[model samples]
Target: MTLRRLMTACVIAAGIAGSASMVASPARAQSAMEAEIIGFHQLCEKGDRKACIRFGILIGRNEQRNADWRRAHADWFWFER
Candidate 1:
């Protein structure tokens, strides 16, 4: 993707991640989803190699109740192993 597209996707991912966790009450499942998404986005943007794997693991383990954070990012291979 172009830099503009990557940046735009980054911004959207941030919004999705933030919106999930900003809920006032932990009683809400959506809050957990939001928080996880936000965290995954954070780790991905920060280039946490483990977070990419972990994010997928989260979705696989938690299901929709926690949001599908795996789809939020594509692997950027050039800088990675």
Candidate 2:
């Protein structure tokens, strides 16, 4: 009800909103990355040697990124063998 209280509440609300946006930003970036990875995947499947290398580098480090890499690997064993 007081001006001081109102300003404190506003600051809290702004902090919460800012944090939520920060959390959301990574998900957006990840989806964009996934899209790029998918495009590379398609290219790799179609016999683009350079694309295959790029795809592996982008999604071959950890288990999370490796999920896509595994799928692509299975689908493109011809290239591997």
Candidate 3:
């Protein structure tokens, strides 16, 4: 594959790796998925720019979810009043 195509595939795979834990059922399944994510994350740490960018996107997504949940729960208090 060309460089552009390779980067796109790696980015897509990184996203899937990020979400793998969410849908994983068994402990073994989760372990395997987590290992895949770790591998990607390690690549990011090693200065692979594309991998680093994808990893940052994954982390940002998690933070966004946490912020959304916190906002929703905080709003619950107002709803009760």
Candidate 4:
């Protein structure tokens, strides 16, 4: 009975940890993507044409319905040429 209780506790702990990690995963990915986008924007500002294009493409692909997205769209169009 004691061993069974221990096993059940371990399973519950594992499940909680797994679910917590799953919840955090998307936030981490989004932050990472935002960091990449910021890096690309910085590079573009410093006259890296390739970075400008890449930044534009990344922002365009995301397609956020926000001012930032609109600004990025303009930047992309300006740098696309």
Candidate 5:
């Protein structure tokens, strides 16, 4: 194969190898969910629907089920958006 083709193949292989080694642990997932909730709350304070829905989903089964679901439905306008 040509040098250019070999380099392209190497780059692709490297990218796949790098991504394969990348794993999101449960701890990382929890942390990300926490951050997302915080950011979503902030956005809700400023009135953002999509973020609110995400926030609700992240927290609905937590200590604020009713409230979160309410906001989620309201945010996305479960009846009408």
Candidate 6:
């Protein structure tokens, strides 16, 4: 009986840990992307022409991925160009 209880507790702990990681995965990805963009932008600001183009391209691609966001920020996109 004691061994069975230990096995069940281990399973439950594993499941909780797995679900928690799944939930945080997307948030981590978004932050990483944001950080990458920020790095490109900083480099661009420091007069790196290639970084400027890369930053613009990344922003454009990201904006195009979400129609509603693209529409809402249409002018900002044009201004960036």
Best-matching candidate per TM-score: 4
**CA lDDT of each candidate?**
0.66, 0.78, 0.64, 0.77, 0.71, 0.74
* Candidate 5 local distance difference test against the native: 0.71
Candidate 4 clash figure, as a count: 0
Clashes of each: 2, 0, 0, 0, 0, 0
TM-score of each: 0.36, 0.44, 0.34, 0.45, 0.36, 0.43
How displaced is residue 49 in candidate 1, in Å? 0.6
Question: Where does model 6 exceed 4 Å of error?
Answer: 1-30, 64-81
What local lDDT score does residue 24 receive in model 5, on the 0 to 100 scale? Answer: 33
Error of 4 at 50 (Å): 0.4
Name the better of 2 and 6 by lDDT: 2
Clash count, candidate 2: 0
Give candidate 2's error at residue 60 in angstroms: 1.3
How would you encode candidate 4's per-residue C-alpha lDDT over 1-81 as one tens digit per residue? 999999999999999999999887774344677788879988998999999988867876755633465665576456445
Local accuracy of candidate 3 as per-residue lDDT tens digits, 4-72:
999999999999987896677554544563455456678976889887776555545676644554465
lDDT of 2 by residue, 1-81 (tens): 699999999999999999998887764344787788889989987999999999878876667657655675576445655
Best by lDDT: 2
Q: Candidate 1 or 2, higher lDDT?
A: 2
lDDT of 5 by residue, 1-81 (tens): 699999999999999888877753333443666567778988986889988887767776576755654675576435644
Q: What is the lDDT of residue 57 in candidate 1?
A: 68
Order the candidates by TM-score, highest first — what do you get? 4, 2, 6, 5, 1, 3
Clashing pairs in 2: none
Q: Is candidate 2 or candidate 4 better by TM-score?
A: 4
Considering lDDT, where higher is better, how would the candidates rank from best to worst?
2, 4, 6, 5, 1, 3
CA lDDT, candidate 6, residue 35: 71
